[model samples]
Target: MSTPQPPTHQQAAPAPNWQAAPGTSYVSPIPITRTHLGHALASEWTKIKSVRSTMWTLGVFLLLVVGVGLLVAVNTTTEDYTEVPYTIPAFFGLILGQICLITLGVLVVSSEYGTGMIRTTFTASPQRYRVLTAKLIIFFVVAFAVSAFAIGLVGLFTSSLHDGESGTPWGRSVLMGALYVSLLGVLALAVGSMLRHSAGAITTMLGVVLVPAILPAFLMLSDSMRTIGEKMMEYNAPNALARIFELDTDSGTGGSQLALLAGVTAAAIAGAYALLEKRDV
Candidate 1:
């Protein structure tokens, strides 16, 4: 009884409340928001603008498109524009400038693969198609805008120099030509995505554009291939641009050329999407 009662254990102090007060939920200091295509577009825009290759390629493109166009315009007279739109001179420059765009397009996707940055890109976004869509949209917009500006500037300069040449409408032809070139860049982009190599994709696109123009000449040597050669010339990129610029009326209508390019580009894009989805980084 009285002598040896065990010392009672001291009650443990209540644990401190580390969470937010009652009825109030803890909020993280960092803000969280859902990502979307707009975010991907912004990211792509930043990447494209910050890269040295973008500046270099685009600078050369402008020089070729505008410089050569102005030079051609200066050398020609009003008579030279009589049978073609004022924009036709721009077509000659674009024939070279388009290579710049194709190169840029290939670099856009392939450079990331080369640097192993695509894994980070996919990790950040998780949706491959969204990233591809952003690339296509940004590249197409930039390519089309730059192309149109250069071509249009040359057209206006030529028109002003000539003063009153009767030819096909400059506005429509200039826009169509710009669109066609942009599509070529897009096709190049798809090829880059598929090949995952800048040099290879660029070479492939160069062949796609230039080979059709040149191979048809060789093909014409054989009677069996003469008709095929004519068709190739009619549907080739150079001839398409020529038709659009009214420089070549025998190569088929500009609309048909655009349709052919559009269909081919669509197929290429589909293939790119499939490969991207199925392949591992």
Candidate 2:
């Protein structure tokens, strides 16, 4: 009974999720570092390379390009190229291969939304704009590289096989062909961001890239619309790419088409950025 026992009290431990500061959430296990666009770029590169969709789409694209290109090369006569130029054969393959790039581009953004992985991506990197920018850069670079490779292969094979087929405009064909594909990819990414649904985005991009090719054919005697339709065909991706190859048109003025595509892509991206900022993940 001697000494009076003091009342004992248990104190509660600080919870992990307790807000330490205004607007500050719980700390993540990832090391705190100054984050930048480079980090987001690396993340985007990893995602694009690791996905099977990228592999399958790009693989089929290469297969179509190489296979059709080689066949065209073997069949082409020196006379056939004298008037048409050597790199024209690549147009046949690239016309189809472009669809693959467009599909892959849509998948890059839309697939994430479809699978709900975009939530995780946004969570890890809170800067939404950076993530979208990273994706656009990574996708455009990859698309350009792959398309250039295919176009380069076709151009080289056509040149070598024909022997002394000078004045082929190799520079314009390879460079512009790659640019055309990359531009289309960027557009598709923008559309994907806008739509956020895989099928809808894919369908919309398909119309953008493909419908123009056929629209001119179907437009009959609408006077004002006929002129617009002809312009659509003139500026359509396939025709523009063909112009790069110096086929179907002697001007080979792909520069104009490239400029137009660049303008459209820039506008679409601006719209996408606006939408991204105003919307929730």
Q: How many backbone collisions does model 2 have?
A: 0
TM-score against truth, every candidate: 0.88, 0.87
Per-residue alpha-carbon lDDT of candidate 1 for residues 124-202, written as tens digits (9 for 90 to 100): 9999999999999999999999999999999988888877565667898878989999999999999999999998999
lDDT of each model, Cα atoms only? Answer: 0.90, 0.86
lDDT of 2 by residue, 152-267 (tens): 88878888887656555576778888899888988999999999998898899889988888888877367768888888988999889878787766655688888999999999
Full-model lDDT, candidate 2: 0.86
After TM-score superposition, what is the CA distance of residue 103 in candidate 1 from its true location, in Å?
0.5
Once fitted onto the true fold, the runs of candidate 2 whose alpha carbons sit more than 4 angstroms away are 1-31, 83-85
Per-residue error for 237 in candidate 2, Å, reads: 1.3
Residue-pair clashes per candidate, as listed? 0, 0
Report lDDT (Cα) of residue 153, candidate 1: 92
| Residue 265, model 2: Cα distance from true site in angstroms | 0.8
TM-score of 1: 0.88
Q: Give the local distance difference test score of model 1.
A: 0.90
